[model samples]
Target: MQAHAVIDHITGWLKDYHATAHSKGFVVGVSGGVDSAVVSILAARTGLPTLLLEMPIRQKEDQRERALAHIEDLKQRFPNVKAISVDLTPSFNTFAETVEVDESEYPAKQLALANARSRLRMMTLYYYGQLNGFLVTGTGNKVEDFGVGFFTKYGDGGVDISPIGDLLKTQVYELAAELEVIESIQKAQPTDGLWDTDRTDEQQMGATYPELEWAMSVHGWNRPEDFEGRQREVLEIYTRLNQAMQHKINPIPVCEIPLKLLNGS
Candidate 1:
C-alpha cells in the first residue's frame, strides 16, 4: 500500500503539526506491539526527539523483553530516540490493595484494575510529553479505535495525536513490514497488554481484527439475504460492541431536566 509514501505522509504530518502547535516532538508508549512500533518509527522520521517509555504493570517477562528489544532497535535506527523504563507493579499493587472491595459480592473490580493500568501509563506519557514539549502519540489502529472501541477512555485513548488511527489492521502490517518492526512483535498475538492474565485482543473483542474490519465495511450494517455463519456472527459482535460503548464513543452526556422537574423548571 505504498508504505514509504504512507510513512512519509505521517512523518510530514507530525513535523507540521508539531511546528504549528509549538511542540518539541513525540512521546510514545512502546508496548512492543506492531502499532506502537510503526508509530514510533514515523515519529522518529520527523527528525525530532522521540521519547519511548515502557511502563509495565504486572507485565509478562516476554512482553517486557520484547519492549526493551524494540526500544533498542529504535535507538539504533533513530538517533533522536531515547527510552525510559518504569515498572508500575508496585504502584498498582498499592492502589489495588487500597481499593479492593469484596470480590465475592462486588466482583467487577478486576476490570477496573485493568483500566487503571492503562490510565497510569497515560499519566506517565502525558507527564513526559508535557515536560519535554512533546505530543503523546497513540498506537490504536482504525478498527480498534473506531469500529470496536477497544481502548480505555482516558487510558490508551488518552493521547494528543493518533497517527495510525486511520489505517486498518491489515494496512498496519504493510507499514510494519516497510519499517522493519521487530519480527517477534510483528508476529506476537495482538493484546492490549492490560490484563493480569495476558488476554489477547481477540478474546476481549469477541472477534479478530480482520473480522471486525469486515463488519465495519459491510453494507451499512445490513444483514444480506445470504451470509456465512461467521459473517453473521461478526455483524452481531460489531453491533453489540457499538451498543455497549456508546458512552465511550459519545463521552459527554447532555444535561436535561428530569421528567419530574421539567414542569416546575
Candidate 2:
C-alpha cells in the first residue's frame, strides 16, 4: 500500500479506537523527529485532543528548539491540540548517579541511562493521561521496534496505542512528506537524542536503512529473495537482537502441571 493510504488506514483505526473507548484524546511524545511528527499530525487530524510532550535532557539547544518548533507547528495545524515541554535532566541525572558501573562499560552504561530517560518520559505521559483521560500514543515504527528491538523494553515501547508500528522507516518518511512536516525533520537523520554526541540510528545498526530495510523486507518478513552477504548480516543482527530481548517481549514463563490434586485426593 502507498504511504498515504497507510496513514489514512491508521488514522481511521485511531478514530475508531477513540469512538469505541470513549477516550478524551491521545498523547504523543514529540522527539523533533519525523516519526513523532507524523504521529502527532495523524492524532490531530483524527480530531482527538492531542497532547505533545517534548522531553529534553542535556540535549543541545538546537535540538530542543527544533522540537519546540515542531510542537508550535502542530498547534497551528491542530488548534485543539495542546503542546507542553518538560526538562527531564534532573530526573535523568538522579537515575544516572544511582546506577553504579565500571568505567570499562561506557556505551552499555550510557545506553541504559538513555533508556531510563525514555522510560521516565513514558511514565510522565501515563501520569498525565490518567489525570486528563487520554491514551498514550507510541511513535515507534516497524523498522525500529521489530527489526532490531531498537527500543527500551518498558520505556519508549510502553504505550496505549501504536499508530506507526506497521510502517517501515522509509514508509514513515513518505508519510511525513504527505503530512507536510517541517522540511528539516522530514529530511533529517533519525537519532535517539540520548546524549550530547551526534549518533545516527544507522550507525548503531551498523548498516544503512535501505540495506537493513531490504533485508528485513525480504528475508525477515519473507518478501521473496535469495539470502546472500548483506542479507546474512541483517539476519545475524536480527537474530541477535531477537534472542537478546526475547525475555522483554514475552511474559515470564511459569511451570504448569496438568491436573494437580491437592490433599492427595
Candidate 3:
C-alpha cells in the first residue's frame, strides 16, 4: 500500500480523463469526510481548474466547519482549487413547504426529503460543472458505491466518473493518509450529510465500515457455505444489507425480448 503510488495513479487518471473529455476543469462537492476530501485533493492535483463547493442544507455546524476548513487548507496547497460556500436551507425550506404529501406515509416523506437534499446538492455541482466546462466528480468508495449502495441514486451517485469507486472504505482511508488530507476530515465519521437525523454511517447501515469492508472482502455477495456463530452472523448481515440496497446497487432492470418479437410479429 504505497500511498504515493496510489496518489499518482488517481491524479494521473483525472488529468488524462479531463484532457480526453476536453473539459476545462472539475467540480467536486466536499462533505468534509475522508472520501470527499480525498476526491477534492485528487481533482485539484490534476492542475486543471477545480471548483469545491460546501453546499450545506441544514447541515450540522460541525460538518460544515470541517468542510470549510478542508477547503481553506486545500486552496492554500493547490492554486487551481477554488472554494465556495452555499447555504441551501432556505431553498429546502421553500420546497418542503410547497410540496404537499401525506404524513401518514412516514417512511416515504422522510426519505423523500432526505433525497431532495442530496439532489439539490447534485444539481448545484452540475450547474458549476456545465457553466465552467468542467466534469463533476463523485466521492463514493467501493464499499458504499457497489457493496452496500450507500449513496442516493442520481443524486450523489450522479457523476462523470468515479475515481475512487474501485477502492474500499479502508482503502480510501489509506489514500487519505497518503494524500495528506486534513486530519479533522480523515478522522471524522462518515455520513451522507443529507439529513439532520444526527445518525452516523454505522448507525444507519447497522455495521461499521471495517466490518462491512471485511464482509465485502470475505463473502462478497456469496453465501458462506460453512461458518458458525459470529461468522455466520456477519454473513447474514451482509446479505440483508446487500438485498435491501439492491435497488441502488442494481438500479436498471434487464429487458428481455418477447416471443412475438422473436417470431417477427
- Model 2: runs farther than 4 Å from truth? 105-107, 220-229, 255-265
Off by over 4 Å in 3: 220-225, 254-265
Backbone clash total for model 3 is 0
Report how far residue 183 has shifted in candidate 1, in Å: 0.5
lDDT tens per residue, model 2, 1-265: 4877777898899999988988899988888888899999999999879988898888877667778889988888888799878888988888878886885966587777778888899899898888889999999988777776778878888999889998888888888888899987877788888766888887776776777677666554552234567667776666566567667667779976556454354
Which order, best to worst by lDDT?
1, 3, 2
lDDT of 3: 0.87
TM-score per prediction, in order, is 0.93, 0.89, 0.92
lDDT of 1 by residue, 1-265 (tens): 8989999999999999999999988999999788998999999989899999999998988888889999999899889999999888999899899987997887878888889999999999999998999999999999888887888999999999999999999899999999999999889998888887979989888899888888889836486334778888888888788777767767687898798897785
Q: Give the poorly placed runs of model 1, Cα more than 4 Å off.
A: 224-226, 256-265
The CA lDDT of each predicted structure is 0.89, 0.82, 0.87
Q: Give the root-mean-square deviation of each candidate in angstroms.
A: 2.8, 2.7, 2.3
Model 2 gets an lDDT of: 0.82
Q: What is the lDDT of residue 146 in candidate 3?
A: 81
Quality of model 1 by C-alpha lDDT: 0.89
* Strongest candidate by TM-score: 1
- Higher-lDDT candidate among 1 and 2? 1
- Candidates 1 and 2 compared: the better one by TM-score is 1
